[model samples]
Target: MADQRVAIVTGGSGGIGRASAERLGADGFAVVVHYAGNRDRAVAAAGAVTGAGGRAVVAGGDVADETAMAAVFDLADSEFGGVDVLVHTAGIMPLAPVVDLDLDTFDRVQRTNVRGTFVVDQLAARRLRPGGAIVNFSTSVTRLQMPGYAAYAASKGAVESLTLILARELRGRDITVNAVAPGPTATPLFLDGKSQQLIDQIASANPLGRLGTPTDIAETVAFLAGPGRWVNGQVLYVNGGAA
Candidate 1:
């Protein structure tokens, strides 16, 4: 099993994270599914991976907590030999205009999105094996400049910066560091409270005329992790022309 590739997917308990974990599992990588608070969903994701004939285990941690995330990475190394890919799909989105957004909300978003990416990517930079890849999450709102997304967009902007700099810093290491900025993905996290009219409007904003599915984002992650070796230090916008 030393030749097997291993992935640590943060936020693997829900939505796009779940899809990415399952897809990577299908791609012949042993996955360590990391969740923040939901053990049941993490178990379910691990089960799906195992059912698909891939190796997987569930781990729980806050992405911004160094100790907790370090434990998750350790689990991957001990369980599957070493880490090869890291898909950081864990983040939070709270929609409020910049002027109206509370300081607490801004702080929370920055802690989870900016600080979380920093914590996780630092570990990946130190731990990923040769030829490994790191895929960090961003948001199309960064480009779309949509309303009520300033805090979220600003946080993702920092993620993009980290991703670009890390790829350059890892020269000669045969690793790729990139960010995927998805737009209007149709997950519970994106759709839970929106009115049907607003949802329809946003869905139609994309040229595809529909909200993006989790699998759509996962396909892009899989490419960066597995076959898309030449792509690095770039932000691939997976927004279906929404931007």
Candidate 2:
């Protein structure tokens, strides 16, 4: 295992995070599955990796908490040597019109989406070995401009800004920083509370005429993590032709 690359995948308990964990594991990275609250799911994510002949471990904490996240990174260092990839897929999306959204809800969204990205990316920047890659999550809704997604879009917009600027800042480190803005993926997070009509509309918006799967997004991330070294600082819209 001395020659294996290591990846710390936040939100490994759910959705794109789980897919990403398994994909990176299959790609030969010893994965550290980071979860905010669900320990069981996190364990399952790690188990899938090890069950398939890859090494994995589970770490738990809010991604926005610096001290807690530092411990999570320390676990990766202790268990797998050093971090070579960071897939920050942990985030929350609550839809409400900006004029009607509660301040508390807006603040909570910012804390998890914006602040979490900041804290985790900061740690990744400091700890990742040379040639490491950092992939953060953004959304196509930011482009779709769906009416109720104002707060969510604003938070993700911050993430996109962070991705671009950080890539420039890491100019000579041989590390690639990029964001994956997936469109209308068929995940619990995307399917929850949406009407069938809405889902169909979203699927139709993409030229592919179907929804993207976690694996679809995961493959894009896996490329960025491993062999897609020349692709840096850009947000790849994995939305099947959705703008």
Candidate 3:
């Protein structure tokens, strides 16, 4: 129906991105599942939305490519009437200490995380209906200051800044902008290089004593996207008090 809300979830192929997409779908938003290179994974995400009787479709492109991402937003408008929410979760994490991190890798991470966010946020800022929301992804590493996370942390730091500034820039537009900074979550992005011992150490450091699941983060995204009307220009630390 024309009045049904639509959400475009970037990085919907896996992890927290997919979980947020699923949760929003369950909440009755028509979803545009956007992926960069994983069509099969994205297809399954869309299928989960459909399988559970929610409306969904898949759109694929490089999130940093303005033209490509513009097309993704266009597809959402064509398919779902208009966009009401944007969950920008497409990003990369390349771990290395500041001294050892390759400049090229750092550039790539920023290109995807920072620039991709700019491209998508620009589009959403232009097209999202009033009363919409934009949720950007960040990492608690920005606060944790963990070693081997210099490049990744820097990128997310940019995300947090952009989210806050944009929220203020959209004054009177009725669109809420916020970033979700998650602590050591068990997604592939967080667990890829850590040993079980290291993982356990990080988990135990949290007062809650465990790694965050995607659902934990998704619930926050859902709240900000839907009923959390007053939560504007904020960075929600969705960790279990690790930071």
Candidate 4:
């Protein structure tokens, strides 16, 4: 019956998305690794899942686009029966102080982060079978009040609100909606062109004394999507006591 467990992990081409896909596959869920533009990486991630004795498929779409998300869901239905879990990790974070942020940059971030969450959450709410779960991604910036992250923080704030509201709206559907807020994670996006000195400074700020790994956040997602159903409507902060 484990093969009956199908999951769709948005943005699964890299970072926490890829980690969650791998973990879900390891947990016996047939995963659909969804990517926006990185086809090769998405295929590789799916292949890794299959190589680990699990079933997986690669799907491509822009999470902020409703039509694209619908196509992805259709592919999942055609390829693997139905979606049992939806892990929405597709987002964009461009840090800039509000005073210095360009309107276009802010709009792009909102379009990808907030609009993307809305589009994917709508699909999951409508298409996910009973006993399914939806996991949304947030960031610790919302709680940390960090400078140069006004737009990014606002976007994640919307996700947190949406997750809680959707959980309430889905009252008796047997589906749990929740969000995970990760701290400074060492993804390619975060480490690119950053100095080791700055990275170390940021790492030292976390109570855990290090930057978070994608696997660290992915493990929490696996729990929420699997047996952690009782923890509904909660913004589970996996920030290693940083916030």
Q: Tell me the tens digit of each residue's lDDT in model 1 across 104-200.
A: 9999999999999999999999999999999999988899898888999999999999999999999999999999999999898899889999999
What would the per-residue lDDT of candidate 2 be over residues 1-243, giving only the tens digit for each residue? 787899999999998999999999999999999999899999999999999999999999999999999999999989989899999999999988878999999999999999999999999999999999999999988898889999999999999999999999998999999999999899998999999998999888779899999999999999999999999999888899888
RMSD of 2: 0.9
Worst 10 residues of 1 by lDDT: 140-149
Q: For candidate 4, report its TM-score.
A: 0.97
- The lDDT values for all models are 0.95, 0.95, 0.94, 0.93
- What tens digits encode model 3's per-residue C-alpha lDDT throughout 163-228? 999999999999999999998888988899779999999888889989999999999999999999
Point out where model 2 deviates above 4 Å: none
Cα RMSD for predicted model 3:
0.7
Which portions of model 3 show Cα errors greater than 4 Å?
A: none
Query: Which ten residues in a row are the worst by lDDT in model 3?
Result: 185-194
Tens-digit lDDT string for candidate 4 (1-243): 535889999999989999999999999899999999899999999999999999999989888989989999998899888999999998887877889999999999999999999999999999999999999999988989999889999999999999999999999899999999999899987787679999999999888899999999999999999999899999988988899
Q: Please estimate how well model 4 matches the true structure, expressed as its whole-model Cα lDDT.
A: 0.93
All candidates: TM-score: 0.99, 0.98, 0.98, 0.97
